[model samples]
Target: MKRREAREKAIQTLFQLENTELSVDEAITYITEEPTNSFYELLVRGTVQNQEAIDNTLTGSLENWSLDRLPKIERTVLRLAVFELLYNEDVPDRVVLNEAIELCKTFGDEKSGRFVNGVLSKLTKK
Candidate 1:
């Protein structure tokens, strides 16, 4: 799958994992019709593996928002975006930020794009 598709799927996987007790394998199946790719595995597993650090990073970047205060979709979108921004060094920061905002817009509320962009812009500046 393309990186974009994988990223979206990874967000879905994270959402599924967050909402249910399903294992990562099960969550992967929950989101995808195609077989999961390396990027998909990388994002989902890496995010899970590094969740504490990622959440800490987000908490610091957020102006007044706590991690738990974010809507579920927005929260999951942030998780995916932060993982890519921190770990996927080969992808351009602009691409990661744009893809994340696009993902939030696609899967989250109307305000999701701007909210994600604002938070991620702070993270990007670091």
Candidate 2:
């Protein structure tokens, strides 16, 4: 699978965790069984290991939009993108931002793409 596809799967997995009270190991196992490439595993591991920090940063970034207020899909996508932007030095910031916008277009509401862009842009500045 392509990196974008893997990232999408990771986003879905993270979103599932957000909705449920599943343990991180349980969530990782659930997502890993899906038919995805190696990149998916890496993203899942990275996101799981850093989820708390990621959520804290995300919550701080959204001045008016609380993390829970955003649509689930949008929240997951943004978390994944923000993780990449803030921690994954291998991925370019532009690529992270673009992939996030694509994810919003694919799985989020009509306004989500712009909302993600705005939040990510703010994150990049910090």
RMSD of each: 1.0, 2.1
Query: What is the per-residue lDDT of model 2 for residues 14-122, given as tens digits with 9 covering 90 to 100?
Result: 8888889998668767876755566777777777778789889998889887887888888788878877877789999999999999988888866999999998988
Q: What does candidate 2 score on TM? A: 0.85
CA lDDT of each prediction against the hidden true structure: 0.89, 0.82
List, residue by residue over 1-126, the lDDT tens digit for candidate 1.
888888878888898899899998888887886777888899999999999999999999998889998999988988888988888898898998899888987898679999999999999899
TM-score of each: 0.95, 0.85
Runs in model 1 deviating more than 4 A are none
> Model 1: how far is 111 from its true place, Å?
0.8
